[model samples]
Target: MRVGIAILSYKRCDITRHTIEQVQRHTKADHELIVVDDGSPDNTQNMLEELGVAYIRGPNCGVVWNKNRAIYYLHEMRHCDVVILLEEDTFPMEDGWEQAWIDGAKRWGHVNLAPSHWPLNDRIGGTGTVSNPIISRYVTGQCCSFSREALSVVGYLDTRFRGYGHAHVEHTTRFLRAGWGGYIKSGRDHNFYLIRSPLKVTCLDKPPPVADYSKNGDVFNSIRHDHIHRWCWRDEEEMAVFHTSFSTLSRSGIPVPTISKRQWFLSDNTDQNLVWDPETQVVISTPDKKDERPRVIATVSGETVQFKVLRDQTFWMTWEQPGEALLKEKRSEAATFKLIYGKNGGVGFFYNGLFLCTDHNFNDHIVLSRPEMKNWEVFHFSGFSDLEQPNNNPMRSDRIQDWPL
Candidate 1:
């Protein structure tokens, strides 16, 4: 599929230049990259000319408007099938990132991916852990993908969410409602590498301000106030936890499976050997002869959770919660689980999966709960079949070494 990328920059010319360079080196598909300079005083125009990317120079429009403008120019004017949006500071990890997203789009019709965002130490907002196949109400524009159909239906980022907070959330909600599936990829990190020019590191002592566009009677706030019954997922008590894993079998290649219902018990007495073979792509849970078999359940594929023992002997869980089901289930699908390493992890439900409302500590063991359901039955699946290994592992050391930093 023909893909396009849009990079929005307010005044961070240096960061924009670096981001463009990284994208050029890493993008593997035939695609167009548009850089929108929102009336910056810096030498952004000169940098774009030097880089030779499709450049749009406009007045000092706010973030929402500039983003919408870029979409209009690229999608409406240039006529691309898909658009990959990025901020001036965000960078892709490798050359095949675009292909991965394109592949996802081809399979699911609509998708959005994001990097992990860890709050600075001592910051009020909890440290952010990335989710795989994220079903959030909104995704950060730092790096995301949108199918042409999605943009055509959802229109653009609501300019009323001018400052920062609720705009992306509002736009994403509309997209989800319009039958778009959101995804956050795993095994990669969108690190906060630099805050080049104009954006600098201040004291990491205080929390970032929560943008309150809701108070101004924006679309997001209107829905929040007027639609009380539709907002039943807002309650905390109605929540459940979903978990899953992705593995590759030896003869088989990479198999993404959902963990079905299974109980697991760890005895206090003996040492259990948990094996994670990258070559085999199999995670084996072989306990000493005496310990109880932890009954752990997972779905093999398609919107189910999976649980497995990682290389470090810690348990890892990931799953995709269907946006439709989340909305129907008034209860939230939120829960905390103890990591294999004993760290805490969990995602809070907001308006179903349309938005990830909060992050909670999972160190303390908590019960698994389900969100309130209206009419749909929760999807369940059997374990995955063995996968076939490819002649060459696309994820190789040489390829990794060559990727732009």
Candidate 2:
């Protein structure tokens, strides 16, 4: 039978690589492995290319849509008999691990190969030697398998669940309601080991940095029992969070009405952005938006944030002068700033306890003209995130590529 394996990956590059490499080296199943990347701003795209596997990298479209991308591609486009879904954190164990899942899917139509199981098979070293039935209404998306019949009847994941949490549960519940039989419990045998990796710094804009489960949970609870999905997922508040996640600011970007003296706001290309010349390593004073400029990147560790100017396709320098904002090629020249968050989903760059500002007025140049976390000092990073970048792209073909199936 033709097998299609889809792996869902987020911001963790090291863990993703470790998972994919394990699957590649151990599994002997005749399957096309496809990694679905949720527009990670890291080297995830670069890592996938080095692995020489098929992948689709798109913007932060939530966990529901992320899984659906792989499901739709593997099941609908590739016409695989059985499709296996895996997350980046799970590692495949032993050789030909796909056979048990294939056999299970062939028998049950759909099955969830539970990754985080009981203590018996929790750690390393367990062949999925035996198979047992899991009496569950829905299956988890961590590591699962589905037959063509299941895909044909159930379709892709319910995107109404939005980014994360209850999406998998709701989708599998629908399948079970349609008589897909009991989900698989990997028997006493475990195919994959779920490893918890450290969360690194990421530019995540979906499911929120810290997911508000109540909203999506209410969504799942509301429509879970309906035989048919005729109801729309958008309420006014839900739509704001669903469509443009940053439209509603998180508590971290909470309202600080007290210190906000001037009005801080989101920046776009329409804003008077600082244009840097790569050759001169200086910020161009020109107001023209058409001119080419190097990408300005920022990194955060602990409570300190450092800025870098991407030149010659490499991070070559730091902001040398606070007043002129000159990019200088020296690590020592790097300026560290503390984030003074504002009410309107922005932050004021507090360098050495002073706000980087423009004299409490929209000036042609930014200067160290403020001392507090006010409007003139505040600038939003969420406005310039990849969450809006790839999602705003009108073409799906631009983000997806044809890989060897």
Candidate 3:
């Protein structure tokens, strides 16, 4: 894969130059390397020019902005499928280290290639290969690589983070929520390490920039977001808004919930030959063609589950009278379902003690507000054959911010 290496450097001219040299010598891959000088005051600019490496010199824009510049330029402008970000202090130790990073990024959309903290245990290999990914939500941005697929979902770091602090953690959080697998390289040939002290300029023409942890920390604390089951993403639930409850699909990747019971997913009708008729307010036989059917999104709030049927327009399934179901334009009076899973795949709903089951023929209609769920449909999550509702959620893509230079 074509990799774009983004080397974020500052006033540490000697260290930055060494880093550039090492990367150019060891990284054996088809890649473009660019250095972003975060307004280095020393000889960093001149030294970069002397080395003949691609470098951008601008006013000190802090760690977050400079790193984003590197990412956007290399990933978008260069059209590189994968972008590997590295700090000047972080240097590669192994030859062909970029290959491992590329593999890690391809395997897990986002991967951290940072070195092991303790120097004594510096050799990291064996189980940490890309084939065997160790997934985690958090990853260090100091020396990391992200596939283009990941950048689309999580976007770049929040520009609000002035210099540095929590931007790495915050950005990583969004990527995990977006369904991109996050990984930290613990495998063989993993060769990236951090220099504890990469900056030392006592006698320079100008002083280098300093980081303000308090300011960055404040910004991070001010903009806090929670993606538990509500007010997070479209994939969480509240469908589209609790956004999509944490995610209805199970680890099996099937349109089923991980819990004992699943909610309703209209797509579940195909194999069972059953579908919910939004207009008629009943479960009917699945149509031979699916294009004729409309789009449906099931949402859950508090303890009630609501379905959004999109055809000519948005409509909600409502019960106007006992045993009479219809679709309404608004959800203010939409019908809700409570699922009750049976021993073998049978499930019933519960608002109070009310439950629904098919008639003696095990067909006829769906909602029969009764005393107990004696006749609850087996695994069939819809009407007619088994009007059971299973869990299925959705995800909405995040918009990227235009952090103007």
* TM-score winner between candidates 1 and 2: 2
lDDT of 1 by residue, 1-405 (tens): 678888888788887888888788878789977777665778887777676666665444356656775676567656778876777777765666676566545544445443445223432221222223433323444655667776666666654344556665556555555556442234221121111111112223645455444443455756532311121111111111211111211112222222212222221111222233344333233344432333222222212233443223434433234211111111123222222110111222222333211112321111123353211112211122112123363322223334221
Best by TM-score: 2
lDDT of every predicted structure (CA atoms): 0.43, 0.54, 0.53
> Sort by TM-score, best first: what order?
2, 3, 1
Decide which is better by lDDT, 1 or 2. 2
The TM-scores of all predictions, comma-separated, are 0.45, 0.50, 0.47
Model 3 Cα lDDT, one tens digit per residue, 195-250:
22111122224333345566767766675453311111112111121111213223
- Among all windows of 10 consecutive residues in model 1, the one with the lowest summed lDDT is 231-240
Worst 10 residues of 2 by lDDT: 256-265
Worst 10 residues of 3 by lDDT: 228-237
C-alpha RMSD by candidate, in order? 22.5, 14.1, 19.7
